[model samples]
Structure formats: structure tokens, C-alpha cells
Target: MMNLCYNMGADLWNLLRTGGSEMKLLICVLNDTDKLDELMIKLAEAGVKGATIINSTGMGRTLYNHQESALMNSLRALLDPDRDENKTIFTVVDEAQEKAFHKVMNEVVGDLARPDSGIIFTIPVDSVTGLSK
Candidate 1:
């Protein structure tokens, strides 16, 4: 069973590293939940195979809401009072797919430069297991 698990993990790693391109773990902190459906559609259109979406809240949101201290109150002004929670999406993509992801994300979520547009970034992935093609 251990050897079988090892072989399966190796296969998954190879699948992720196909085409000699490095894999990246793309993370997007989407402030607006309204755009989630559209974003998922756009990602699928862009050939993104899979993703994991998590309901999340920023530290500022938590602190501002719970803490009544002077500093927390001051920080509250910096945060958007309207939105309390955020949706964070994670996916793995190759170099080419990363570009496609960026394009589709911008199309659905608007420019990251603008306020409330959300933040997107990527981290290098060394190996992956249990990610099926």
C-alpha cells in the first residue's frame, strides 16, 4: 500500500509538471462574493481544471468588529465597513494557464489596482499529490 501511494503521488507530481513549465499556486482574495459565480465561469472558460474556494475574513475586519480599543477603532476607518467577509480562491496552474487566469480574473473582478477589486498573487509549487487530471 505504501508503494502504491508513492507511485500515485509521483504520477500526480509529473502531471502537474508536464510541458516543462513550472507550476504556481494562484491565490486570490476576493472581497466581493457577488463576483464569485462569474469568476468561476471565467476560470473554467480559461481552462483552469480545478480550484478550492474558502470563506475567509481579513484580520482588520475581525479586529475592527470585535475590539473597541482606540487602535482597533482607528484601523477600522482604513477597512471597508460594508464588507465583513472575503472569498479566497486557490488553484494550481502552469505558466501559460497562469496568464490565462490573470486575464480572466481581471475581466470578471476588474483591475486589482482599484479599491475593492481584490488581491491576486502566486507562489511556486514544488510538488503536488492527489491532484488528478
Candidate 2:
């Protein structure tokens, strides 16, 4: 089972339908930037209409690159001569599409429980404007 880390309650889906707020904001921090294209393709196949990607680097990468310590800098230079920034993807999906989204994410990125894989999470969207149906 996928660990979503959030409890939307047992009647969450029903509440979403009745409350007229079935939309959820799904965010994913993709560590392996190389897999971005494949992930996008799989997400489209899984019914995600649109998503936004931001080029971002984590704190560790930032420190590794800028740290004054010669030892850490030397290690960084030796280990990762050319490192890429992570891709942070954001999308809004309805209740039904949320499951498909997670499924495809796992399929593309593998088990997130593994180290350095990636992270995916969702937040309830109360209201959305400027979005097309």
C-alpha cells in the first residue's frame, strides 16, 4: 500500500463529492531528474491533464556546492562532477484521478520508501479559480 501520509477520513471521497471540492493539489519532488520525461508520459497516460515543473535543488545539494569546507567540496567534485537540480511537479487532480496519479508516479519512480527515490504528497483544495474543466 502507498503511504500518502495524510488521512482524509473514511468518508473523504463522499465528502468531496457532496462538498463540491474533489480537487487535490498533488506535489512531487522528483530527485532523479533524468526520469522526468518518462514520468510525464506515464502521468498523461494515467489521465493527468496538466502539470507544472520547477527546477529546484535541495538544501544538501546547495550546501555541497557552496560549502567552504575543502574536504566536502573535494568529495562533491569527485562524487558528482555534474549534478542536476530536482524537478518539482505540481498538479491539481480530482478524487478519481488522484489514485491514478499516485499509481503512475510509483510506476515511473519506483518505491519511494527507498533512499533518494523521491517524495509525493497531496493537499486538499478547497476552491480553485483560473482552472479549466
**lDDT measured at residue 26 in model 2 versus the true structure, 0 to 100:** 93
**For residues 18-110, what per-residue lDDT tens digits would candidate 2 score against the true structure?**
356478899999998889999999888888889999988888878756756878678776887546478899998887778888888788888
Q: Highest lDDT: which candidate?
A: 1
lDDT of each: 0.83, 0.80
Write the residue-wise lDDT of candidate 1 on 1-133 in tens digits: 9999998887676755575677889999999888899989888988899999998988877875785787765666578554677899999988888999889888887889998678989999777666655
* Per-prediction backbone clash count: 0, 0
Lowest lDDT 10-mer window, candidate 2?
A: 1-10
Q: Per-candidate TM vs. native?
A: 0.74, 0.72
